[model samples]
Target: MQELHDAPLAPLTTFRLGGPATRLVTATTDAEVVEAVRAADESGTPLLVIGGGSNLVIGDRGFEGTALRIATTGFHLDGTRLELAAGENWSDAVARSVEAGLAGIECLAGIPGSAGATPIQNVGAYGQEVCDTITEVVAYDRTTGETVTLTAAECAFRYRNSTFKDQPDRYVVLRVRFALEDAGGLSAPIKYPETARALGVEAGDRVPAARARETVLRLRAGKGMVLDPADHDTWSAGSFFHNPILSDEAYAAFLARVRDRLGAGTAPPAYPAGEGRTKTSAAWLIDKAGFTKGYGTGPARISTKHTLALTNRGQATTEDLLALAREVVAGVHAAFGVTLVNEPVTVGVSI
Candidate 1:
């Protein structure tokens, strides 16, 4: 375990924004992690658990409590079962799985975060979400002062949310176990249309696992979803907003509003989310609402390569980013009658 006082947090996140924490603890093992958490809890100090820092947005005021950075290292693979420490780099783990000829997580390549955080938000991209392959999450329950393993079903995963996210302070994820497929070294059937098109295969066709992983990484790089320090466009938390899933009645009202704003013939992109629910693209909404790519004059702006990402252009504050996000949300709501919600977790701030 390593401790620092008043540590700056911007350098830890992909966004490169945010202030400092009163105290920062970096734990390199599960035991250290638990001990750190227990200490904070026992002392009645507010605790903020951070892994990868990709999906986090800390305010300029910074955290006044203990910010525990999970940096533990553990990667145990037996046959098709894989267990990773909470702090393992997510993209690197995906690459390792692909190298091992695993077929489950190839599509999740280039997602920025730790393996532990994947379950927290049920992290998904390119038609793949972690909830599909994740078998269990071992977490230290702060409230009960005990470590528990919860099955995937018990996690209560929904679109970009889970039990851990719903009760953020209850559990500190320590390890994640996944069940991957061998598939004779071939990838899982391609589900996302864009990925399939890029690979020149029909949806449901399987390619080499490594090829699938590389292709997704390529696609992500093109859209600035992949982290690249040299590129301002990549200085983002992947997608700034979640695709809004609306009820049937809400979808009907939104479609009416879309037509009202974009002429009677205008049609919005909609996909079936679940029974009587439709998921519409937040990127499409932002673009149609007149906030194009690179849509801001301030330090914080939408990525030039992707409309979904809100980035920090070298120098930006959390307030600047939030301002841009709020503008985009209001503009989209005004134009389409649907409000966009942020994907990243915010601290000491609301949008």
Candidate 2:
């Protein structure tokens, strides 16, 4: 375990906008992770867990407690079953699975963050979610003070959320186990239309796993979703807002508002989320609301390549980012009745 006092956390996150942490602890093993958490809990100090820091938004005021960075390394692959330590890089894991001819997570390529973090938000992109292949999550239950394994069903995975995310302070993820498909080096049936079009295949067609992964990476790079240090556009917690899911009545009203404002022919991207619920694209809403790509004049602005992302243009503070996010959210809500919710987990701040 490596410990530091008053450590700067801006460099740890993709946004590079946060202030320092009162104390920072980097744990390189599962045991160290547990130990660090236990010590903080025992001392009654507020505990902040960090992984790849890709989906985090820490305020300029900083955290008043210990910020524990999970850095453990373990990638165990046996046959089609894979177990990864909490700290394993997520995008690299997807690439490795593709290299090994696994079929499940190819479409999730280019997503940043740690493997442990995937289960928390039920992280999904293109068409694949971790919940689709995740068999179990091994976590230290802070409430019980014991390590326990939770099955996939027990994780209660939902769109962009899970049990761990709902009960953020109750568990510390240690390892994640996945059951990948051995599809003769072919990818899973493509589900996202954009991905399918890019691959020159129908929606249900399967391409080579490597090809699927590479194509997704290319698509992400084009949208500035892939990490690029020199490019300020990639300095964002990919997709700042979750696509709003609306009830039948809410969807009806939203559609009416859309047609009223943009024109009767204008149609916002809508997909069936569940029974009587519909999910609409956040990007479409922001763009139609007049917050187009590269929307801000300040240091914090929307990505030039993607309307969904709100980025730090090399010289932004957490407050600057939040201010821009609030403006976008308010603008979207005023234009349409739907409210936009942030996707990233905010520390010591509210959007």
**Residue 297's C-alpha lDDT in candidate 1?**
96
By lDDT, who's the top model here? Answer: 2
Give the distance in Å from residue 14's predicted Cα in candidate 2 to where it truly belongs: 0.5
Misplaced by over 4 Å in model 1 are: none
The true-versus-predicted C-alpha distance at residue 225 of model 2, in Å, is 0.5
Residue runs of model 2 more than 4 Å from their true location after superposition: none
Q: How accurate is candidate 2 locally (lDDT)?
A: 0.95
How do the predictions measure up, each by TM-score? 0.99, 0.99
Instruction: For candidate 1, write residues 1-351 as lDDT tens digits.
Output: 899999999888889888999999999998999999999999999998889999989899889999999998888999999999999999999999988988899999999889999999999888888998999999999989999999999999999999998999999999999999999889999999999999999999999999999999999999998888899998999898999999999999998998888899887888999999999999999999999999899999999999999999998999999999999999998888888999999988999
Candidate 2's residue-wise lDDT over 1-351, tens digit each? 999999999899999978899999999999999999999999999999999999999999889999999999888999999999999999999999899999999999999999999999999999999999999999999999999999999999999999999999999999999999999999999999999999999999999999999999999999999999999999999999999999999999999999999899988999999999999999999999999999899999999999999999988999999999999999999999989999999999999
- Candidate 1 — worst ten consecutive residues by lDDT sum? 259-268
